[model samples]
Target: MNAAAIDTSTPRLRDFPYRLRDNVRFGDLDPNQHVNNAVYATYFETGRVTLMKDPQYGLMLPGFAWIMVRLDMHFRAELRWPGQIELGLGVARFGRTSVTCDQVVFSEGRCIASAQAVMVLIDEETRKPAPLTAELISALQPWLRRGVKGTRPDLA
Candidate 1:
């Protein structure tokens, strides 16, 4: 979607079940004096990792690993340094071997960026895709976005 079509006024954090707060540092800024665009991806990664490692979420599995296969981000506003960024994340869709996460970055109560990431579960030994275990799927159910069905939801 175009920048003009994005609804930056709405605080989408409420829609996500997991949140990670981080502060923009001086080093994260560019010569233009705004948070660098690339830094937003790192903020999204922090949110994803926090959720994946949470015991309550049970996203991490022994002898298995998760890798991000795809990421799509939309920047709605310029994030300035010396401010806090609140990142919210939730499962947007689930597949047999992967999960799609929806995330948003909020600064000063405004949505600055939004992202969707597809992460695949892999077997460490074989280094190949692996099916999600039932236990893991059950643990992730509560975090699934409303109206999103498993096996891949139409993100569009």
Candidate 2:
């Protein structure tokens, strides 16, 4: 099979997860006409924030906040100038005190980059790790990917 044929059948990563679409402005490109590396990080942030703000998901409990504990990213392809991009994200693991999420940035139906993050739940006053609330979990239940493995480690 030719490269074009291979690409056509490979599932577009955007189709599998919740995605947000954005257009790349000229300002988002560099002198070389490729998207600035920093902008890809912003795309990941956009995906996470969108998920959190949705009424069906997010830090639902009063006085609860999800703080980033760590982030990891891998770049697979360069995104060139002048194209629409889609950012995809989904919960990888949800724990009592923390959750891990995966996000991908796509251009022209191809995944250009991917990022993974670990976010911990914090108590507003104590500023320390806290158990995941049932209400909060229920809110995120609809977004969880089926057949995902392993339980979240105790983060407190």
Candidate 3:
């Protein structure tokens, strides 16, 4: 599909605050000469890493770890190699111990795929769900998408 045919006026694309640029490498493609379905998960991981590792927006805490609990992805279009991709990320919802992240992959100004992943905060030593700290919640507030319900108060 031609990049020019993509629609970029979606609210999700406009609302996402975190973005990362990546390249489609030769290794990312499969026998079909397009990026493999499995590779989309890796791209989402890269976006997660980029957002969670940012000094100002980072979620990493000492003695804490994040565990992915769920992922839902939609492959909108096939991705080709030798091109650049833009990854957009946002927090869809937050819970006491987990957060749902929404992400989209775009190439040539067109969205190729989108995904939602749930990640839980855990105590590294105990391997148990951990409450989100005030500091962590504050940091994430800026990335929250409006109108998205968040936090199971009972869990909090």
Candidate 4:
């Protein structure tokens, strides 16, 4: 889904189930003295990867890998270095073989960007799309977007 379709103009970090705190490194700044757009992708990746790869999450399945197929990012504000940032993510939708995630970056309570990413589960050996298993879906239920049916009700 597109950012406009989701109406994420003024997203709240609290809406995301998985969140991360990070620093805006000086090296991330562009010639314009603001964090580069490419760096924002890395910020989003950090959140997704942490949630997927962390042993506690149980989202990563053996013999299968998650590969990002699409990412749509909306730049909302300029993020400057010497500051702190918070990245947020929630699963928005699930297909037979892919999951769509809604992500946001906040700095000093301001949303720097909103993004929608689609990641497909792939068989490690054949490198082809693989169907999501029931166990994997159950594990991801806790990480869904606020309005999604399976989202953790305790999150607010």
**TM-score of every candidate:** 0.86, 0.80, 0.86, 0.91
Better of 3 and 4 by TM-score: 4
Q: Number of clashes in model 1? A: 0
Please give the clash total of every predicted structure, in order.
0, 1, 0, 0
Residue lDDT tens for model 3, 1-156: 553243344435666778889999999999999999999999999999878877776678989988999988888888998899999888887777888888899988778998888999999999999988877877887777655554332263
* Pairs of residues at least 3 apart in sequence or in different chains that clash in candidate 4: none
Residue-level lDDT of model 2, residues 36-88, one tens digit each, is 88888788888887788666555556787878887777777888767888887
Model 1: per-residue lDDT, tens digit, 28-119?
Answer: 99999999899888999999888888866677889999999988888889988789989898888877788888889999898999988999
lDDT values of the candidates? 0.83, 0.74, 0.83, 0.89
RMSD of 1: 3.9
**Model 2 global lDDT (CA atoms, 0 to 1):** 0.74
How well does candidate 3 match the true structure in TM-score terms? Answer: 0.86
lDDT, candidate 1, at 82:
87
The model with the greater TM-score, 1 or 4, is 4
Candidate 1: which stretches are off by over 4 Å?
A: 1-11, 146-156
lDDT of 4 by residue, 1-114 (tens): 564554645888888999999999999999999999999899999999999999898888899999999999999989898999999999998888888999999999999999
- For candidate 1, give the lDDT of residue 116: 85
Ranking by TM-score: 4, 1, 3, 2
Runs of candidate 3 with Cα error greater than 4 angstroms are 1-11, 146-156
